[model samples]
Each structure stands twice: as structure tokens, then as C-alpha cells.
Target: MSENILDIKDLRTSFFVEGNEIKAVDGVTFQVPKGKTLGIVGESGSGKSISALSVLQLIDDPGKIVGGSIRFKDEELTTAKTSRMRNIRGNEISMIFQEPMTSLNPVYTIGQQLREAYKIHQGLGKKEGTKRSIEMLELVGIPSPEKRVDQYPYELSGGMRQRVMIAMALACKPELLIADEPTTALDVTIQAQILELIKNLQEEIGMSVVMITHDLGVVAETCDYVAVMYCGKVVEFADVETLFENPRHPYTVGLLSSLPRHDIDQDELVPIKGNVPAPDEMPSGCRFAPRCPHASAICSELPELETQEDGNDVRCWIYTEQWDGEKGVKVYDNETTS
Candidate 1:
């Protein structure tokens, strides 16, 4: 049996918006091993968050899992009932959302929220659960945790609130944690601190993590593997070092190039040429063809992700001998990988 904690295959999440069906996660496949972090990188509409939510079957009304299999701890989560899902959600797979303010109930004190969360999974008495919550707060680096536990979310700084959120997520000591843009709302220093806190906690608890973010820098600093998403599909999948050093998919290249570089010339930021395509109106062909610097005639016909010799997977015709971005050439008569 594999040591992986999470495995998703051909997962597709959709939503009903304006009387039309929209595909948020289209055939996403990946695995997260115990004690490892898999960074899912993409723009806002690339379906990274929805994919994570699908694993826990948290897609609310109007949004649904239309197709796929989600496996956690070798158990299939795709068809699991709500009661079964409840057991997995906090106890086996906790989530740290992007915004801390909305996640925590403002009506409750910090201690009350944490105690309730811990008690649900631990089945411990209120006193023991409260004690565990305070210990977790301290473990996450909150100063004078005993005192801080009595404070409200508004009393804490942005960084501190984020830490509390992390602590709450870890209170259950889950086997998997899905962090969706946990640091995007904070400043750089706070972002660093949160990332460090997550890394340290991951090491201590040995839980597999799914880190979803648009920032490539975060993925580079913390993740072991990367899945670069574009228009609801994973366009590039590779090991961290390989993806960073040798990204082949045009969308992945665009993302990496757009980052501001002090070492490079100010004019050299290679921003992605187009915004994310609308869900319903996604192009019939390659979704990123319009923006891809390497796009060609064959790109108008769509491209399938092709596996390469180096274990890097790319979904561009340029790499698959169908089109050449440079010199405007088309080599293949008709080629597709399904």
C-alpha cells in the first residue's frame, strides 16, 4: 500500500452560475504523501481552492462534484456521506482558509472557538480541550498563550490572527491540511512568519499538506512538488526544482516570468499575456493559446498534456512537436494525447 495520505484522480468540480454549468476543477490528478507538501499554483480562477474543497466534499449548493475520485488514507471520499465526511473534515483533514476573520466566529472568544473545535474531534472534557487549545496556541508561537486565549480575534494583529487560525487547524492534529492562500492577505514579513510556522508544525506533526497559492515564491520556498494550473487544468506538473528550473508549459512560464526581479532588467517581467478565461466561455482549443508566447496554428485545435523524459509534464504543442512558437511553424499533421 502507498504511504500517500491523499490521492485525487480525474476530479471535476462544477457550479451552476446564471443557469449555466461552469467547470472549476477539470480532471485534476495528484497525490500528497504523508509529511510532504504539494503546492498547487494558479491564478484566481484556476480551480485550486475548489479542488481542495472537493476532497472534503465541502462544495456548497450550486457547486458540486460532477465527477472524480477523492481518496484520503486509502478511503474513498468522493461518495462518503456527510456524517462520514464530518469525521474526516476536522479530525483527518483540517483546512486553513485564506481569511482568518471570516473563518472564526466573532461572537466567540478565541479560547471558546478553539476549545469547541478540539472537543469535537478529541471527545475530551471542556477543561481538557481548553487546555489543549492553549497549548496549541503556545506551540504556534502566540505570546502568553494563556492570556491571549481569552482575547477576541479583533484584539490580535493580522499575523497573530493568522497564527491562531493555524493553531486551530492543527489542534486536531489532522493527517492532511488544505491551506488555501493562507498568507495572501498579509504583508511580506507576516507571510514569511506564517509559512515558517506551517513548515515547523508540518515537521512536528507529520501531516501531508496541500498548499494553494498564486505566488510562485511561496511554492519555491516551501513545497516539494508543484502543479501549475490554468483554466481549470493542470498544465504543468513536476518536482519543485525541475518545475522552477525547467518549466515547459507556456502558462507556467508566464507565471514565473511575471514575477518582479531586481537582478533582471525592469523591462524583462514576462507577464502572462491574457486574463484567465471565463468558466463557460473557455476556448475549445488550448485555453492559454492567446497568451502563450509559444502559441502557433496547432494551438487553436487544443493540446493534450504530454509526459516528457525528465518526468515534467507539459500541455503545450510547442514541446510536443506540433507547433513552434518561434519562427511561426507547424510540424505535426494532426497530433493529440488523450
Candidate 2:
């Protein structure tokens, strides 16, 4: 098998609202290695969800993937026909949306929705589909699979509902699974269980996963590699360990510093300095320049994503040879900018 299951390059998804084009995903690039989980993480509105939507071609009206390429198992999804895409979605590639309540049809029973995928993809009979649906529920650790299959989504608890969503996504044995905040509204314990279940299922099925979330804890626990996005662009891309241990970009550093750690007690939780820039009012140069403490006049020009000697990519002037910080780059080390 090839090393990469999904390859996305310079993906730009735009929305035309009130005659102004808003670039929700701007020049984002990354790849999902076969059978490995890649976590796309950032604060909400940083285009994390838009990047995932662009992959499955699920962007609604006014928003469309306008540039770049999404290659899944060597096939270019950008130019793939709608018919082909329809066939691919839920069969070869499936997505678990953020909210199970909103994504699932309240009118339909759990079994009905789960069977839909098997029927459409494999042309399974009603009886076989029902059997497989129950099996999926069991695989995802939902208790009393047979009983749950006959029940509606509203009848199940939040955690159970999330498991049902996972079961539905994995019913057809998709080669790739895109989970958009799988644990969103669930309590902390339930969140851990859902994440563990996904990890266990991925190992058993040997499927590549794209976990889109804002929680760094989730990324550390579930992802092998991570892509950090800010203002519709990827600011950092590295393995989970490298990212946690030695983050390069100022934005990434800020995110790590803000995370609450039990190992060290702090007076209060550190927060990122400013809100993400509005799409219409994006900075002319570096999108994060206004908030980056290490930013200098050279930041007036956008810095391209460049590979460092450590095998990670960062988009910041601090890593460049042209860095002109008065305190040198040492201040960024072991020091919180906030």
C-alpha cells in the first residue's frame, strides 16, 4: 500500500457572501498516512471544519473548493464527477459529523440510518443490512445492540448517540474516516471513552482517520501527526510528540502554553492574546502578526511554510534566517509571550 491515503495541497475553499469572497480554507496543505490518524486542530473558526468539508465535497452553497487538489488513494477528488463523489462518500470515505443530534434524522430509527450506507454501498438486502447494523453498534461498544438498533437517536444518551454516529460511519468499512469533533457536548468521561473507542476501532480496522478537533489533549491521545491552523491557514505541521515538545510558530506556542496541566499549577489558565482575524478584514501580511509577540517589521510580508532541520514545517519569521527580534529567538524559548 502507498504511504499516504489522503494528500491535500494548497486547498482553498471560498464562500461568496454579499458579493465578497471569504476564504475559509486558504492554502492549507497536509497528508494522512495510511492507517494513521491526522489531527487538524485550532480554535473554532480557524477553518478546521471547512478543511474537512472540502475533502468530502460537502461544502454548501456559497462555499466551494476553488483551488488546490485533494487526492485520496491516488485519485484527484477536485475534478471527480459528482456521481463518482457520491459513490465515494460513505463507501470509500466516510465522515462523522460534529453533532450527532443534528446530523442524524430524528424521524428515522437508528437501524434505518445505519442500514442506509450498507444498502447504498453494498446493495445488501434489508435483513443483511439490519444484521450488519447491529454488529456495527456492538463494534462501537453500544450496549444491547439489537435493542438500540430499533430505537431512535433521541432515545439514546449523548455518548451512545456519538457511538451510533461512529457505527454509521464505519458500517461500510470505509478506507478513511473523518471525525469532526466526535466528542463535542459530551462530558469529560464520555469524551475520553468516545476517543478511546475510535482509536481502538481504527487499530482493528487498519483505517486512516482524520480527527478534526480543538482539544490538544485529544490530539495528543489520538493523533500521530497534527496540523495547526490559524485564520484559515496552516501555521504548523508536525508529529504529535514534536509539536508538544518543541512547537515552532508563535501561535502554536501560545496554544500549548494556554493548556492547563496537572503537572504544574499556575495562577490561572493562559489564553491566546486576540481573537482570530475576520475573513473580510484579514491582515495584508502575516495573518497572526497582530497577535504574535515575536513579530517584527519583516512580518509585514507573509512567511511561507518552510521545513526546519527537525523535520517539521512552520510558518513564522522567527524560524527564518531573516529573523530580526531584538531579544534574539531565545526569548521564545521557555518563556510565555503572554
Candidate 3:
């Protein structure tokens, strides 16, 4: 059997707002193995959320997938019609959004929502669905789930609500789980709890997870592999250890250097030189060249993201040209100016 559970190939998603085309996700490619976590980390507007939405075919309104393929369990989802897409949405690929409060139905009781999730996907009888709902609540670490299941969304704490969302997503035992900034809205303590719970659950069930976040600490803690995105493009990708220990791309290095982790001294946080470029007017050449220190004449021509030796990959001319291999050549390591 193939180890890869999800393969996204060169996906490009765009939206038309007032007759203007805004490409939100551009040429993102990555693979997630069964029972492992692949973290997509970048700042806001880097296209992390949009890429996850594209996988589920849920990008609404003016947004649409413009190109490339999304393969789940060897099935192509890129061009699948709405009717067929419905069969896969929550059944095969479940998603947990960043804001569980807004995502949950505030008007409905928690039991009603969870039972609907179970009934819709599993086609269980009312009593069976109710039973399963309680089990799900318990699974997500909600205490006294039997009682909590009957409570409304407003009655539960923020952490509990997020847990409910995860429970609903897990009700069908989906082969893959897509979590979009799952902890951004929660407090520090709750964030740790939610992340820990997700990791533990993935370990027990052997489900592939695509955890999307801007938090490098979260990626370092849970993800086995990671893709660093910037301005709708994946600038670097490699296993978690390799990415943190030896980031190859300038953008990736900038992101790692700026992380608010203790290993990186508080005074040593080197912020990226420029803001995330807007989608409408992206820079030519390397999308990051204006802010890249190692950028030279060659940087005026875009570099392709290609596989390096030992299964690592990067999209910077530094790796393509000058690295002798003892240490990665980081252009933005100190966030210098040319």
C-alpha cells in the first residue's frame, strides 16, 4: 500500500472580486503520509487557509480553484462535481477551523449538532447517534460529556467548543483531518491542550493530518513534515527536524529566526524585512527578492522549488549555487539590507 494519504500537486486558487482576479493559493505542492502530520506554516495571507479550503472544495463566493490536482486516497478531487464532492467532505476529509465559536451553531444544542454530524455521515439512528455524540465529546477531553453533550454552544468554554468541533470532525473516523489554525483563538494553556489532544488522537487512530498554522512552535512540537509558504507559494519544504535545524530558503530562515521560542533569544528575533506581499501586485523574479539578502542578479530570475539530495527541497538560488553543504546559506539570517 502507498504510504502517502494526500498528494496536492501545483494547486492554484483564485477569486474574482469586483472583476479583479486575486490568486490566493498559487502552485502549492506537498504530500502527507498516513498517520503523520504535515504542518503548513506562514504568516497570514501566505495562503495556508485558502490551500486547506481548496482541498475540501469549500472555497466559496468569488473564489475558485483555477488549476492543479488534489488527490486523496488516490482519488482526484480537483474537478469533482458538487454532488460527488458532498460524499467526501466530512466523510473522507474532515476539517477543524480556527474559530470554533463561529463555526459551531450558536442556536443549537451541542447534542443536536453532534448528533447531526454522526447521523449525516454514519446514518445512525437517533439513539445510536446520541450515544456516539457523547463518546466523541469524551474523546475530545470534554469532562462529563454525558451532560456537556446536552449543553448549548454558549454554555461551553472556548476550549470545550473547540473540542466539540474536533469531535464532530472525528465522528466519521475520516482518513484525513485538516486543521486550519486550530489554536489561534484560544489562550496559551488551551492552545497547548488542544494541540496535545490532536496529536494524541492522531497517534491512536493513525489518521493523516494537515495542520495549518503560522506558529512555528506548533509545527516543531507536532508536525513530522512541514511546508513553509509565502505570498501564495511554497518556498521550502522538508521534514520537521531538517526544516528547523537546516532551513534552506531565505523566507524559511526568516520565519524560523523570528519565531518567539526560548531557543531563539528574545533579543535575537530577526523579523522578516518586508510585509507579506499583496496578491494583486506580486514582485517579479524571486517573490522574496526585494527583501532577500543573498539575492543577486540570479535572484532577479525566479528559482524553482526542486528536490535537493537526501530528499530535501528548497527554492532559493543560495542552495542552487553556493552552499558547500556543511551549513545552509541563509540570506535573511540577520535580515540584512543590500
* Model 1 Cα lDDT, one tens digit per residue, 26-135: 88888787789999988888888889889888899899999989888778899998899988878889898877777787778899989887777677788898788888
> Which regions in candidate 2 have their CA more than 4 angstroms from the true location?
118-132, 138-145, 157-159, 260-267, 331-338
> What does candidate 2's lDDT look like per residue over 103-191, in tens digits?
78899999999888789877888999999999878777788999999999889998788888887887777889999988766678767
Clashing pairs for model 3 are none
**Better model by TM-score, 1 or 2?**
2
Error of 3 at 99 (Å): 3.1
Which residue pairs clash within candidate 2? Answer: none
What overall lDDT, based on C-alpha atoms, would model 3 receive against the true structure? 0.82
Better of 1 and 3 by lDDT: 3
Q: What is the lDDT of candidate 2?
A: 0.85
Estimated TM-score per prediction?
0.87, 0.90, 0.88
**Lowest summed lDDT over 10 consecutive residues: which window, candidate 1?**
329-338
In candidate 1, stretches whose alpha carbon ends up further than 4 angstroms from where it belongs are: 119-132, 138-144, 154-159, 260-268, 321-338
